[model samples]
Target: MRPTGPLATIRNRAAAVAYPVFYRLPRGLRRWLVRRVAPTYTVGAVVLLYDIDQAGDRTGQLLLLRQPGNRGWSLPAGLLDRGERPIDGAARELAEETGVELTTGQLTPATPNAVIHHHGRWVDVVFEAQAPATETTLRVDGAEVHDAAWHPLADLPPLSRATARLLAHYGISSPHTPLDPQPTSGQPDQPGPA
Candidate 1:
C-alpha cells in the first residue's frame, strides 16, 4: 500500500505536476534525471510458488527465475500492466517468467494480501501459490529470463535482495547473502576444493 494522509497527498500532487514536465524533457536529459534526480515509483507483484510435496508432507520448493536485470535468482515478479489487479498481475507474471500456469483462485495471499514495500524500490503485492511438485514444468524464454527452476526453501542459489527479504518476512532464513550464494556441500553447484 502507498503512503496515505498528508504526505501521500503532497507526493501525489507533486507527481501530478512533475509528470508532464518529466515527459517534456529531452530523452537524454530524461534518462540522466532518472538516474540522478528521481526515483521511479512502481507497483508490482511477486510470487513464491511452492511445490506441494505430498510425499515429503511439506511445502516442497520455491520457483525462481534468472532475469536479465538481476544478478542472481529472483522470485517471479513484474510490474502491473495498466488497469490490472494485483492478483491477476501475479498470475500473469508467474506464467510469463516460468511456464507454470496458475489461476488466480489458486494463489493464497502470503499471510496478508496487503502491499509490501520490500527491499529496493518495490511496492510488491506478494502471494504464495502451490502446485503438485512432480507435475509442474518450467521453461524460460532466454530473452528476458535465462532459467527457471524449483529450489529448496532452505538451500537456494544466490538470490536477489527482494527475494531474500520476502522469504525472510516469512521467517525462512536464506543461507547466502543476496548477491552471492556460498557453496554448500552436496549442492550440484558446490565446487570441490582444489
Candidate 2:
C-alpha cells in the first residue's frame, strides 16, 4: 500500500467516526470546503408570496422587499439561519422582509440556484409561497427593507437576473397594467410559468 503518514493517519481515523461512516463529514465542513473551493456555496432562500383575489384568481402580483443595497426592488429573501428549517426560514423571511405572516402551507421549497455577485457570492434555495387572499398593511423596517409592496406581475422592473429566471420557471405573469410601455432590459420579459 502507501507509506504511513500523519495525514493518512488522520484520514483513517476520520473515516472510523460515525459521522464519516453514516453521513460523511458534517455538512458544515463539506460546505466550508465547497465554499473554499468554489466560493459559491453560501446558501440562502427567496420566498415568492402571491396575493390572490376574491374570485380565486391569482392577482398576478407578488410581495417584494426593497433591501438596503438593492434599494429599488427584489424578491423577499434572506440567508438561512443555522439549524433553521427551510420552510420556517422562508416564512420568517417573508414576514421579516414584508411583514406578512404566511403559514407553512404558503411556502414550498424551490430549486437551488446561484448568484455570482450581488453584494457577495451566494447560493439560493428558492421557494414559492401563496400569500393569503386578504390584504395586510405593510410595515417595513427602513434599515433592512425600506419598502414592501405587491407589485403587478407584468410590471416588475429590473430585479436580480437569478430571480427573473426563477419566475420564468414558475410560469408567473404580471397582469396587464395600463402604465406606459417601459423598455425591456436585456433580461427575459415573459410572464411567470403557468
Candidate 3:
C-alpha cells in the first residue's frame, strides 16, 4: 500500500498542478493521453543573441528564417546531425542559417529540455548568446531558408510558441507593444505544416 501521510498529500497536490488532468488514469492510459496531446516531434538545436553595436538600446534581434517546409518565420534553427552535441548543433545551425560562426565562447544553453509539439515533430535544444551588434551579412540556403533577417525584439513576425517562450525567458516582450507584465500564451498567426 502507498504511504498516507502529510508528505503524500503534498506530493499528490504537486503532481496535479504540474501535469495534465488525466494523469490520474492507469499508467498506460496516462502515457497514451500525453502522447496523443503531443504526437509528432523531432529534435533541433537553436541559437539566440543580440548584436550590441548595430543593435543599440533596442533588445537584440533574433535570427529568423523563412523556410520552405513551414513557409513561415522561425528561429535560426535546424535538426541535430546524428551523434552531434547539442551546443555544436546550435552553433552549426547558427552558421548555416545566418553565416555567423558561433564560436565555443559565444554559445550557451537557453533550454536543454525538449521543445514539444502536438502539431508537428520538432524538439529543439535552444542556445542563447549576446554579441556585438555589427552589420553582419547573411547567406541563407534557398532549399531550406528562402530569407534571413535580424528581427528587433519588439517586432518579431509570427513565430513558433516555443521560440517565443525562449525569448520571454530573456525578458524580451512583444514587438508590437510595450512590455506586458505577463508574456503571452496564445498562438501566433503562422500556419504549421499540413
Candidate 4:
C-alpha cells in the first residue's frame, strides 16, 4: 500500500526542502551525490533507416523525422528504460517514433558510443538498418514527430548537427547547403540606415 495523507505530506515537505539544496550544487557534485544515493545513468539509442529502391538501380534514401518545435530534422531516437538493452531500445524507439519495426539482428552499430551534455550527460548508441525495397509508408506520433520522410542520398532537408555528422561519418554527402546566419530580427540582411 502507498502512504497518503499526513505521511505523504511529510514526505513531500522533506523533498521540497532537500531538492533546492541538491540542485544548488555543481553538476559533478550533484551527479556524485546521486550516485551515492542511488544507481542512475542516462542511456539512449538513435536509429537510421535507409530505404533502397531495387527498381531504381538500388538507390538509397535515408529516413528523417521532423520534431515539433525543433528547427532541424533528426533520426528517430529515445532513452532506454531501466534494464533495457541498447539494441532493444533502438528497435523500440524506431517503432514508437516511425512505426517501422525491426528485429535486433537487423540493426547494426553505426558508431562508437557518443556522450553528450544537454540538460545532463547522456550516452547514445547509434544503429542503422535497411528498409525493405517494397516498404513505403511511414507513420509518426503526431505529438513528438511533426513529419517523416525519406530523402535521396544526395538530397536531404536541413539536418541537425548530429545527423549531419553521422552522415559525414558514413561517407554520405548532404546536398543541402548550410544557411547563412540570420539577424536576430528574423528578416533578410539590410544595410544600416543610409
The TM-scores, one per candidate, come to 0.66, 0.60, 0.59, 0.63
Model 3 misses residue 176 by how many Å? 6.9
Clash count for each candidate, listed in order shown: 0, 10, 12, 0
Residue pairs clashing in model 2 are 153-174, 154-174, 170-193, 171-192, 171-193, 171-194, 172-191, 172-192, 172-193, 173-192
Candidate 1 lDDT over 92-169, as tens digits, reads 988997888999998878864544452234467789888876888788899978998888887887876656655655
Candidate 2 weakest lDDT stretch, 10 residues: 185-194
- Weakest ten-residue segment in model 1 by summed lDDT: 185-194
Taking all chains together, the TM-score of candidate 3 against the true structure is 0.59
**Candidate 2 vs candidate 3, lDDT winner:** 3
lDDT string, candidate 2, 82-179, tens digits: 88876787788878877788787867776433222323345556677765446677778889888787877778755544455445546553332222
Model 3 CA lDDT for position 11: 99
Model 1 TM-score? 0.66
| Model 3 global lDDT (CA atoms, 0 to 1) | 0.64
Ranking by TM-score: 1, 4, 2, 3
Displacement of residue 30 (Cα, Å) in model 3 is 24
What's the alpha carbon RMSD for model 3?
8.4
CA lDDT of 152 in candidate 1? Answer: 89
Q: Look at candidate 1 and give me any clashing residue pairs.
A: none
- lDDT per residue, candidate 4, 71-178, as tens digits? 677788888888999899999999898888899998998865453333233556778788853666778879988888887777787776555654554566555635
> Candidate 2: lDDT over CA atoms?
0.63
Q: What is candidate 2's TM-score against the reference? A: 0.60
Instruction: Show where candidate 2 strays beyond 4 Å.
Output: 1-40, 111-121, 132-134, 165-168, 171-194
